[model samples]
Target: MFYMSSGNDIPIDPDGSSSPIPDIDLSSILGNTLLIGIAIVVIAAPVVGFMAWEPVEEGNVKVVKKWGAASGTVFEPGAHFINPVSQSTVSLSTRPQAYTMSSQQGDGNRENTDDAITVLTEDGLRVDIDITIRYRVDSAEAVNFYKNYRGTDAAEQRLIRPSIRSVLRTEAGRLPVTEIYTGEGQTKLKAAAQETLQQDFNEDGLILETVQIRNVNLPQEYAQSVEQKEITKQRKQQKENELEVEKLEADRKRIEAEGQAEANRILSESLDQNVLTEKYIEKLNETDTVYIPVGGEGYPQFVRNIEGGSGQNSGQNTAQSTNSGSTNQSAA
Candidate 1:
């Protein structure tokens, strides 16, 4: 028997008849190899691309570092092509974050603890303060923030929390315990603390949004003392108000009396002798009887008609005689 080699046209036999074996086609094998290679590449291309691409979500930025050094480029929210073997990306959230320290539970981003801050006031009294700070990595300076703290989460632990504690301690120390317990003074302290912390955060490439003093715990004895003082003060104010009301009443009464006296004085000054005589005559004309004072100033000497009897005849005679006497007196 004869057998043909697949690589060449030579025929060889080990046993049996001489029948030619078909030569194997090298082109087909090569074509099949090329197709397999192409298929492998097609499958592996996506895998390589998937490994090299980095996706940055919204509200976040990715900092790419190449060869252990920053590439000085930040990728915004989109698909970014990067060399996975030689370069890597660090994704950081540019959104606002909160760091809260309080005795009560807070939102998910808070550090709830019973360990309130104890600070000595300027007057040497102790005060416990619970505070919350809202902050964020400056989006424009996210790379710098990353360089300083190496990460956004790290910025909170290393930069924000410690700075807040330090600023709070310093600002609280400047105020008296009495003032610290008051609303106005607490507001001032919060402002001062916020300013200080903002400055500190700015230095570390972070933005300080707000600083809130959640609660302030005062000594029991001091709180009671303040309560008593407030009670006494309110009582004193009440008494003062009552006295003011009384004073106003007295002033009103005095003014009314003075007005009445002035009215009486003016009336008295206006009534003269002639005015009185005219008033008396006007009253005499309204009745059938007349009375005359005998010997007083501004009074007639006698009364002629004294009764309601039929004095018409006598009255006419007397009136005629009186008319003649009045005419003679006028002529004289």
Candidate 2:
């Protein structure tokens, strides 16, 4: 009743050999171990590759795609996982970018170049203008903008500049020449230009910052004429001012003269004729003697013969006596 340790004494083995009940191969175990290690490496390569990638930076977003087709969902900045074989991401900046373009000088050989734009005034005068536009990209919409308008170098060259230029020219064309130069007018024009640009560019995914007019170049002849006209106007105004001053002075002098004449007239009217006669007699008597003119004399004869009373009416008496002597001379 003894049992064999291997299949040696088993009924199933045709020849009794000193072997265990089940055969185990050390080479097969090692081969299986090697296959498992190879399988682990094959699976880990893609996992490691996926783990190593990072998404777009902060303040930016990644445009995710599957097999080159957009997923329509944006991925924010961080470490992220994507389909290793089919999905990908493209990052775009979400920051604002300012653009500045200055006008190029025309042929420098000419002394007087027509570096002017002809703008029409409301009064139909043609004026020259110089201006600048300052603008920036909108960060919130730059991601979409990069994908669409700035898709490639060709798009930027062919589309963006032309659009901006067209919009600017259209706005400038609508403004009058005078409005572009004056202070309040320039302010209004700038506001209108900014609004027009914002409306036009915003639809095309652009943001506008500001538009400024740097200079307005009127023709030299026109400027000189305006100055001369201003000078003439000032001179005329000065002459009118002088005339007004003279008129006021004349009126003042006339008023003073009239006032003095009225006072003199009132005094003359208030006096009695008898009082004037008495004043005349008193002045005559103040001469202290009298001269009588005789017809046969070479000169008037002097006489001091007022030998009447030295009474209170002496002045009146002298006048009367002179009159009586004149009557006697006439009678003789």
**Model 2: per-residue Cα lDDT at residue 84:** 62
Candidate 2 has what TM-score? 0.44
Please write out the lDDT profile of model 2 over residues 208-228, one tens digit for every residue: 666765556656887787679
Among these predictions, the greatest lDDT belongs to: 1
lDDT of each: 0.76, 0.59
| TM-score against native, each model | 0.68, 0.44
| Deviation in Å, model 2, residue 146 alpha carbon | 4.2
User: Over the stretch 1-332, how does candidate 1's per-residue lDDT look in tens digits?
Assistant: 45555885556557644456789999999999999999999999999899898999998898889987767789989888999789998888878877777655543255454656678888989888877788777767777877788886787778766776777788888888878878887797789878887788878778888888888888889888988999999999999999999999999999999999999999999987667767876775575445556333322333232322335654564566456556655755
Tally clashing residue pairs in candidate 2.
1
RMSD of each: 8.3, 14.7
Pairs in steric clash, model 1: 1-15, 1-16
lDDT of 2 at 152: 29
Q: For candidate 2, what is the lDDT?
A: 0.59
